[model samples]
Target: MTARPPTVRERRLAGELRRLRESTTALNLEEAAEGLGWSKTKLSRIENAIRKVTAAEVQQMLALYSVTGPRLDALVRFSRTTRQRGWWDVYENSLPTDYATYMGLEAESEWLNSYTMGLVHGLMQTEDYTHHVARSILMRFSPASEVERRVAARMARQRAWTERADPTRLWTILDETALQRVIGGPEVMRAQCRRIIELTEQPNVMFQIMPLAAGGHPGVVGSFAILGFPERFTPNVVYVENMTSALYVEDEREVHTYALAFEQMAAMALSPEESVAMLERLARQ
Candidate 1:
């Protein structure tokens, strides 16, 4: 069977497990599996995060590996929380794995830096625009009911930027073409642009427009987002989406590349005040 990449939970579990395994120099994979009375494949899967690692399983492995005290307690606690579900859990089977992962990460993000060349970023989209776009893209293959469900899911993602109790700072840079494009017709575009204007009023939100004259910039290649987490240990991620799949770059070097691109794009875009004025003018047009 083809091995797929580990999900967030899997990666966390695997990292901890691998650390534990390496700490005991005498404990090789075969020896560890034999001592735990488990198959080598099971041990490998658990270590690689190719399979679910339950609290009970973790307890057994920790006990066999001679783990004790606060460290064991912390690992067990982490194991328990891994089973917890996020808001997007309901759409697990509906959304692609990559998209689902993106939502999960976005939900935990403390800050987001996004650059879009031709479309409004997902977190900033209005319901009408979301519906129109989803319908146009999905109507060919998905039923109307399914398309509506997807739209609802998309709208739900907006909570990351809207919930003031724990607001996620969003810095979005859009190409002027995105504002001029009539997504759901003039009325919908008007409301959409107006919504963007209103969103700019929030302290946690920022907007910039790359004018038509800022022709051929680094972001002209595509769109992407750099998501930062509050936890110091959780490294920032750069997420890039294509027509069929998405890429998550966690390595510091690659993430830095995306960060530099966003900085350059933001530099060329209109100032916050200018962007709001641009939106207002587009809405009226």
Candidate 2:
């Protein structure tokens, strides 16, 4: 039988757990293992994320490591959510394992902040616009027919913005260059820009632009996002996309850095009231 696919999140958690263990003083681990009445092997598996680690055990481990402050609390909470299923599980057969994990995170996010360097966020994209983007992106691995289905799946994912009873809130920052890049030509770009204007008016959505004239910005780091949860039971995480792979960061410090950057982007970009006006102006051109 095939091994269960390791989620990008799981692999990361395991790596971090192993790093913590490797760097831990033997005496500290010994004392903690003894107090918890757990075998060293068992602790190892937990740290490796090879098996489930209960919140109680994680709490004990954190205590042993003297990991106090909000970081500890956040780690414990993240452990609890590590096992919860994400909606993208249904499309497991369609997407690559790592991309499946990304979809799950997207599905479960309570609040998502995205900055686009080249195109619009998928959540804010119209079906045609998303199709154009997905097919172009998948040109390497998939044939034309397969790409169409994948494009459909991507567009379906966007339905979360409008179809959910309680939709995930999205705050997206698009660059003026991306909008001006003319996705499907002048008519299509106008539609896309108009869609942005409409979505920005939703009570739960915010759309804004970073004018090329705004010059350099926090997003000069390229595109990234922070996915926040409504429940305190989970730690907020940052998602980063690189050329070869995507990464998830759950460390509160890292998450906050991205979150602060997002806040700055929102503040420095147009206000929501003016953002709509800005989009309207762009769509007209």
Give the top-scoring candidate (TM-score).
Answer: 1
Off by over 4 Å in 2: 6-45, 54-84
Deviation of model 2 at 82, angstroms: 6.2
Which 10-residue window of candidate 1 scores lowest in summed lDDT? 1-10
lDDT of each: 0.81, 0.72
TM-score to true structure, per model: 0.79, 0.78
**Candidate 1 per-residue C-alpha lDDT over 1-285 given as tens digits, one digit per residue, 9 for 90 to 100:** 235445565565565676677774479999899988999999998887787788898988989878888778878877777655677766777888888878877877889999887788887888999988888767568888877887888888886447648888899998888877888899999999989988899898899999999888888888899999765435688889987899878667888998988888888889999999988888888
**Global CA lDDT of candidate 2, please?**
0.72
Off-target runs (Cα >4 Å) in candidate 1 are: 1-44, 54-80
Writing each residue's lDDT as its tens digit, candidate 2 over 1-285 gives 125555445544555554454455455555556766898777666655566666787778767666677867777777666655555666788776556777776776688888888888877788778777767777667777767766766777877547888888888888777877877678778898888777777888978878777777899878888887664445677888876688878766778988888888877786677767777887788
lDDT of 2 at 143: 77
